[model samples]
Target: MSTDGRSAAGERAHDATGIAVEEGIRSLLLLMPRVVGRAKKMHIPEELQSFSLAPRHLSLLANLVFEGPMTVNDLAARLEVAPTTVSLMVGDLSRQGVLERRTDAADRRRTIVGIAAAHEKSVNDWLGGSARAWRAVLGPLTPEQRRLFVDTFHAYERELG
Candidate 1:
């Protein structure tokens, strides 16, 4: 007999559940590097080449471009990075004219970030390219399968929390 109202065989079953879960997680971890490599091969716009932002900054820009303006602290929280990192990214983007910072009308002390007009075209182009690439990858799947796969991915990301 085992504690926690489980028999010895029950404990083995519980342990197997954990091992199987861990195995699935490890498999995803193994694929992570390859996914990143494939993503890096995608074309980037000439405008972005001069800025040379890292993957994190690119992700930040994507959020601002698509989701509308956000403050440095809000962006930092969303990206799960340090506030200083966001501040630095925003400063660099501001200088590169990829981002514009303005004082929030509601709050004078807060600075909100928005994608600059010059960079919007590039941002939209990148999003379109990414969508095409994803469609290519998922095109073979049935619509139901694609929906299930996307839902599973979101569940996994939520589990990270």
Candidate 2:
């Protein structure tokens, strides 16, 4: 071990910095649910009310709407949820006729879930409108500014993860 880089003072400073970063991250994570709650009050549709919907549901729906069908396990991995949880959520959505499950052509053992035909247009419209709103809000930013914003947000996400 190199002694020059292992001073007691350096170790204490590093510990203090780590503690402060963790506290800051904890505070930010705590605030996220409140922010999501406010946004839901502002924009979530009445049709989704019976499902005890959360942002996680919106996230799942959006992913399916935009990215096309995905297997329950793949979706769980993307959403950072358990496979059983995803299966339950997909089962509920399927029951509501919002999602449809189909056997994957290449993988007989896997079931791919996607928005039902009847719900496709509505899902696309909602996501499109949200995209429009985001564009309106952030469109004025220069390319450099937009890049910086994206980079910083991704860095924040990495830290939180």
Candidate 3:
């Protein structure tokens, strides 16, 4: 009776994983958008709002803060974007005094970009909101359950790659 024509149950219908899969997908379907929307709203510092940094720009900043600085090529790879696209974002943030780009001491041709120290307070404030939101959402879980949740998501991501 299902779309795949399996009497409304998949092959794992009788299995533990099947029940978990059904519940998990249902939970994710309900939570994914709300989580992303919370992150999108939480990731931007108030001070940077005057500079017209978009969600993409804020994501870049968040990535830098959490993952550390990187060269344009490395950042592009991580973001799954072309180097030029990353270059444009870096240039924009750099010009706005939100980021600093400098030559790598060992590699003259590589330019590393990071969040400027001058704006750390504002950036931290933005990150704080995101952290608070995640805590509010996930804090109810036991530590072991939280770890399992994190590990599950990491496994999911690896499977994607």
TM-score for all models, in order of appearance: 0.62, 0.59, 0.68
Q: Where is model 1 poorest over a 10-residue stretch in terms of lDDT?
A: 13-22
Error of 3 at 41 (Å): 3.4
Better candidate number, 1 or 2, judged by TM-score: 1
lDDT of 2: 0.76
lDDT of 1 by residue, 1-161 (tens): 34356455544443533554345556778997888787888778887788887888878976775578999999999888999999998998899898999999999999999888888888778856766777798999999989998999989789888
- lDDT winner: 1
Q: Candidate 2 on 108-153: residue-level lDDT in tens?
A: 8988899989877777776656667667867999999889878988
Where does candidate 2 clash, by residue pair? Answer: none
On residues 1-161, what C-alpha lDDT tens digit does candidate 3 reach at each position? 23455554553365644464455567787998897786666545567778887868867876786678889898888888999999999998899899999989999988999889988778867765766667797999999989998999989789779
Where model 1 places Cα greater than 4 Å from the true spot, the runs are 1-34, 128-161
The local lDDT score (0 to 100) that residue 34 gets in candidate 1 is 89
Error of 3 at 46 (Å): 2.2
